[model samples]
Target: MKKKFKILIADRNPHVREFLRREMAGPGYRVRLAENGREVLKFIYGDEFVDLLILDPDLPDTDAPALLRKLQNRLPYIPVVLHTFIADLGHCPDIFNVVAVVEKGGSSVERLKTVVYEILAKDRAKEKIRNNMQSAGQKKAAPATGGKDEQK
Candidate 1:
């Protein structure tokens, strides 16, 4: 069976978290909600893998720079989407894995969904290409039989 994409949505507001959870989960994504920076760390560092992260920089107890630095050091491949107000955008750190930033608004949920889809789709394409290259390398590297009749 194909694996369902796992998304971690980190936000300070309960309503926003629940809203995003319902929206993302409706389309068959495995959604996990984090109300604070601690929960976000827990979910990311735990056993299960997360394919994408939708994060609000205003998460309590930890600042965006610190959290982003940790994420970059540990799991650089896991893409992050910053969902924040327009004012907070200027304060966002220039991190490697943060693929996009969506402004918080009434209609931002749809934009967030679209960004998530695009990032995950690109990830899937890269994975497919890597798998193909690996298989091709393996085929090329296979040991050849040593016999006089064997073609060169």
Candidate 2:
């Protein structure tokens, strides 16, 4: 059986969180919610692995840029989709790691859905390549002694 990808949605508004959680929930993805930066951090540090993050830059507890930096430090490989009112993130170099910057406006939810699908597709491609490389490595390492006793 295939495992579902886990996504963390971090927004200050409960409605927004619920909306996203509902939107992102489906057969291929598992959605998690966080109302603030602290909860987001806790979720990240938890045992459950997160595959993606949908973050709102207007978080009440902490600066979004700082949170992005912290997330990068902790889980650099996880892709982030920054959903915010402020679309001009060109000044924030730290947010360069974000795979998508979605403006919070009419039709934004649809846009977010599209971007999530695109990002998850890319992630799956990368995972496949990584797994192939690992399997190849294991195959090469398996014959260290030729699986037989040395010649007499």
The number of clashing residue pairs in model 2 is 0
lDDT of 2 by residue, 1-152 (tens): 65689999998899999989988899899999889989988976778879999988777788778888888888889999988877445545578469888999888999999999999988888888999999999998875564567665
Distance from true location, Cα of 36 in model 2, Å: 0.5
Q: Please, what is the TM-score per model?
A: 0.88, 0.85
Q: How many clashes in each structure?
A: 0, 0
**Once superposed on the true structure, which residue ranges of model 1 sit more than 4 Å away at CA?**
26-28, 94-96, 144-152
Worst lDDT 10-window in candidate 1: 88-97
Report the Cα lDDT for candidate 2: 0.86
